[model samples]
Target: MVRPDKVEAVAEIAENFRGASASVVTEYRGLTMAQLTTLRRSLGDGATYRVAKNTLVKRAAEDAGVEGLDSMLVGPTAITFITGEPVDAAKALREFARTNQGLVIKGGFMEGRALSVDEVNRLADLESREVLLSKMAGAMKGTMAKAAGLFAAPASQVARLAQALADKRAEEGGAAPAAEAAPESDTDSAS
Candidate 1:
């Protein structure tokens, strides 16, 4: 005999779990309502923090095809459903936990993989997606510049060689006239 509201809540949680990119389970035993609100605000648009009954969460996880959350669901648990960037959400959770000792990060799941607290901390240490992309783009640009320089080297060397040959020809051409004039004067003297 499940209540209608509880059934609806389970449905919503299941939907969230299905849609989330990552989800962190935290034990918020000693956190006050105001502190919870502050933490939620800190998570920002990247994550949705919610408190659900362990039984409902279990049912929702099962419905959503997510496994290994049954043991973590015990105690006063709050789940942070991360839909945007997992790194950002992990950073927020880690920072909040540092200041507020009441929040204990149990574990999480990301991309169908379970994560321990140490794993979550590692995730937080990772740079954001945009930062990583920008670094990659910079590296690609540098590689392309080097490739262009390599490609142009032969053409530049050819041009320099042509200029050197032209200069040599000019020098020879000027000397020929002087040599002929000197010979003509010699011939006139000899005659």
Candidate 2:
């Protein structure tokens, strides 16, 4: 005697679970619909927040083969499915919770593992993936530039030394006085 609507809901939730890069469960007990809308808007394009019955969510998780989140599906749960970046979603949730105080971050699932509330907070503290990647790229570029300089330094120094020696020889050639050869000429005559 299962309702078609219920089955559909489960399927939708399961699909969301499958498609999300990460999922965070939060308790939004005291927030009104308006506040919820505001929270949703704040999550931006990378995440979607949905309110669902705990039973339906549980069933969906089971269907989706997502484990370690059953305990998090308690008490007026709203799940945030993140598709872009997990850190961005976590940061949005954390920021909203800090201001609203009604959005309680329960836990999350990411990368085939469960995240505790502390872990979620830690995730929020991290920089976005793009930022981290750019920093790493900058560091690698700097290292490469340094290596190139290290590889080229000795050759450049040797070239400069050779040029300096050549300039000295040229200057001596230009400054050659016939008087300096007088001693040699005198020795040759004595011989």
Candidate 3:
């Protein structure tokens, strides 16, 4: 039979699991109190860090509809429940782990798929959603501009050709009297 306190703890864990958009399991052994406090503060309000028992966490994960998280529930486990962007949460954890050797990432889960530690690191390297969208918009704009330039090239050439033809006709009209007089001189020489 489970105690009331244990049931409440499992319920709380289950709530966090349901609320998180992504979850990263980490090993926080050998960390000083100050280091732990700093790490929690660094994660900010968007993320919740809690040290939970493996069995309880497993039960919570199962209740929350997340499967395959049992393997990550190992020694000194602390799960970071993220409510905001998953990529940003991964970035934060990776950065924290880089500076603090005590905090080691085990693995993570995103969008119903279990990810390895390396996969989570790779996700951290990805640009933010806004940045990716801006890059795509810029690429599309550049392609459209190139197509417009290609479409206008022939029109520009046609305009230049028309101007040149008009100038030639003007020069011929201005010199027509001189051309006619030269023919008369040739006729007089023949006579």
Per-residue lDDT, model 3, residue 102, is: 96
Q: Please, what is the whole-model Cα lDDT of each candidate in the order they appear?
A: 0.95, 0.95, 0.89
**Residue 75 in candidate 1, Cα distance off native in Å:** 1.4
Per-residue lDDT of model 1, residues 1-191, tens digit only = 87999999999999999999999999998999999999999999979999999999999999999998888988999999999999999999999999999999999998887888899999999999999999999999999999999999999999999999999999999999999999999999999
TM-score ranking, best first: 1, 2, 3
Number of the predicted model whose TM-score against the real structure is largest: 1
* Model 3: per-residue Cα lDDT over 1-191, one tens digit each: 88999899999999998888888999999888898888888888889888888999999888888888888898889999999877777888889899999999999888888889999899899987789999999999999999999999999999999999999999998899899999999999999
CA-only RMSD, every prediction? 1.7, 2.3, 2.4
Question: What is candidate 2's lDDT per residue for 1-191, written digit by digit as tens?
Answer: 99999999999999999999999999999999999999999999999999999999999999999999988987899999999899998999999999998899999999888899999999999999899999999999999999999999999999999999999988888767665788889999999
Instruction: Sort the candidates on lDDT, descending order.
Output: 1, 2, 3
Who is ahead in TM-score, 1 or 2? 1
